[model samples]
Target: MTVIVGASAAGLACAEALRRKGYTGPLTLVGAESHLPYDRPPLSKQVLSGDWEPARARLRSAEALSALDATLVLGDPAVHLDVPERAVHTASGRILKADNIVLATGLRPLTLAGQPTLRTVDDALTLRKRLLGCTNAVVVGDGVLGAEIAATARRMGVAVTLAGPQSAPMALQLGPRVASELASLHAAQGVSLRLGAAVTEVSEDGVLLETGEVLPADVVVVAFGSAPATDWLQDSGLTLGNGIVCDSRLRAAEGIYACGDVARWHHETLGRMVRLENRTNATEQGIAVAANILGADEAFLPVPYFWTDQFSAKIHVHGFVSPDATVVEGSASEGRFVVRYHRDGAVTGVLGWNMPKQARQHRAEISLRCPAGVAASTPGAA
Candidate 1:
C-alpha cells in the first residue's frame, strides 16, 4: 500500500502518476479539506473577480478521481507520521499503514502580524465576499501573490494599495529593471504603489507605515510568502530546512518520498536545494516522485518555469539568476521581449514579457550553463 498525505495538487498528481506508471498498488490519500485537488492560480483572479465559479478551479474531475482507484480520507489531517512503523495517524483518530509514504502536505501561508491570507478555496471565497462591500484594500507584502491580489481587486473596482519593503514588487525574482516595468504596469491600472514602505502596524482602519502614514483600507490581505506545512512532522525524524529536505531523487527516507511545495529537494543542476511554490513545479515533482518510488533513477532535474498574469500582461521566467546579471536579449520596455540573465559569462535565466517563443529558444542554455565555468566550454549552446 502507498499512503499519500494531503490530497491537494501534489497528492492527487502523485497518485495519478503512480497508476499511469503501472503501479497497481493499494493507494490512499488523506486530506484536511473535504474538497478534491483544485487549481489555485485562479483563486486570485477569475474566482475573486466573479468571472468563474470555485468549482472551475478543480484540477481534475470527479470521474477522473474515481478512475484513479485510490481511497480518499477527507476532512482529516495527518497529525503523526511514524517512519519506522510505516504508519500515519490522522486527526480523526485513524491509523493508516502503508509500505511506502509520500508527504505532500504542501505549505501554509506565513501570517503577517495576524492579517488574513489566501491559500485555500474557503479563504478565497471569504476574501471575495469581504471585497464586495470594501471600497479600498491594503495588501501587505508585494510578492507574486500580493501583485495578483492587488491587480484582481483593482479590476474588481476596489481601490487597492500594494505596500512592501522592496523597491519594486517581484524585484527579487524578476530583477530590478524588469520589476520596474511591472510596477509601472500596475500603477497605470489604478493600483496604488507603496514600494519600499515598511509596514509598522495593521489595524481595523488600515496599515500604518513606519513613516507615520496610514493607508485607509477596508480590508487587509497579507501575501508575505509561506512556510512548509511540516509542523505535523515535528517529531517524525526527517530533516527539515525551509521544507522537508529531500535527496536528488525526491526521496525523504528509505521508503518515503515527498513532492510539491513541501519538499525542498536538491537540484543537481543548480547544485542546491530549492522549494518551488508554483503549479509547474508541483505537477512535475509529483510525476517525478512517482517514477522514483518505482525504482526509477529519475534525477528530478528541471529548468524552473513560472508565469504570472496581471492586467493585460503575462510574465514568464525560466531558470535561476543572480543579483548582478547582464541582459543579453531584448529590453523590458518593449511589449514583447526576452531578457537573458547572465552570471560569469554564462546564461543563468531567461525572462519573457509576452515573448514565449524567444524565451523557450534559450532553454538549452539554462541546462548547459548551470555550472559556473561550463559556458566557455559549450560555446555553441551558449
Candidate 2:
C-alpha cells in the first residue's frame, strides 16, 4: 500500500503521478482539510478577487479523483508517525499503515493573533467577505502573499495599506531594483506602502509598528511567511530542520519520501540543502518524488519558476533575484522588459515584467550558463 499525506497540490500530484507511472498498488491520500484538493495560488488572486468561485480552484473533478482508485482520508490530521512500523496515526484514531509513505504535509502560514492570513480556502473566503464590507485594510507583510492580497483588496474598492520591514515589497526575493519597480506599481494602484518598519502588533483600531506609528485599518492580513507543518512529526524520528530533511531523491528514510513545501532536500548543483515554498515546486517535486519512489534514481534538480499578477503587471521570474540586476531587453520605463540578475558578475536569475516571452527566451541563457538548481541561492556563472 502507498499512503500520501497532506492531500493538497503536492500530495494529489504525487498520487496522480504514481498512477500515471503505472503504480497499481493500493493508494491512499490523507488531508487535514475536509475539502477536496485545490490550488492555493488562486486563494489570494482569483478567489479573493471574485474572479473565480471557490469550486473553480479544485485541482481535479470529483470523477477524475474517483477514477484514481485511491482512498481519501479527509478532515483527520496526522498526529504521529511510527517509522519502524510505517504507520501514520491520525486525529480520528485511525492508524494508516502503508509500505511506502509520502510526506507532503506542506506549510502553515504564520500570522499575528486574531489577524487574518491566507493559506486555505476557508481563510481566503473569510478574508474576501471582510474585504467586501471593510473600508480599509492593512496587509502586514512585504512578501508575495501580502502584495497579492493588498492588490486584490484594492481592486475590490477597499483602501489598502501594506506594512512591512523591507524598503519595498518582495525585496528579499526580487531584490532592491525589481522590488522598487513593484513599489511603483503598487503605489500607482493607490496602495499605501508603510514599509521599512517592523509590525509589532495588530490592535483593535490599527496595526502597531515598531517606529511608534499606527496604521489604522478595518481589517489586518498577515502574510509575512510560514514554517513547515512538521509539528505532527516531532517524534517521528525524522531529521527535521527548516523542513523534513531528505536526500537528493527526497527520501526522508527507507520507504519514506517527502515533497512539496515541507521537504528540505539537498541540491547537488547548489551543494546545499534547500526548501522551496511555491506552487510550481509543489507539483514538480511531487512528480519527481513519485518517480524516485519507483526506482528512477534521478536527482531532483530544477530551475525554480514563479509568477505574480498584481494589477496590470504580469511578472514572471526564473531563478533567484539578486540586488545586482541589469535590464537585458526593453526598458524598465516601458513597463515591459526582461532583467537579468547577477551575483559576482555571473547570471543567477532573470525577471520578466510584462515580457513573459522575452523572459522565457532568456531562461535558456540561465540553463546554458548556470548550473542546475541555480535558483536556490547558488551562484551561477556567465
Task: Supply the TM-score for candidate 1.
Answer: 0.94
Question: Which pairs clash in the backbone of model 2?
Answer: none
Model 2, span 351-375: residue lDDT tens? 9999999898888766424433234
Instruction: Give a tens-digit lDDT track for model 1, residues 1-382.
Output: 9999979888888899999999998999999898888888899999888998999999888999899999989999999999998899999899999998999998899787767799998889999998888888998988889999999999989999999999998887787877888999999999999889789899876899988889998899999677889999999999988888899999999888999888888778767666777778888888998988888987987777788899988888887645655556666556777777777677777778887777888766874334532121011111
Assess every candidate by TM-score. 0.94, 0.96
Say which candidate scores most in lDDT: 2
Worst 10 residues of 1 by lDDT: 373-382
**lDDT of residue 168 for candidate 2:** 97
Predicted structure with the largest TM-score when compared to the true one: 2
RMSD of each: 4.3, 2.7
* Model 1: residue 202 alpha-carbon error in angstroms: 0.6
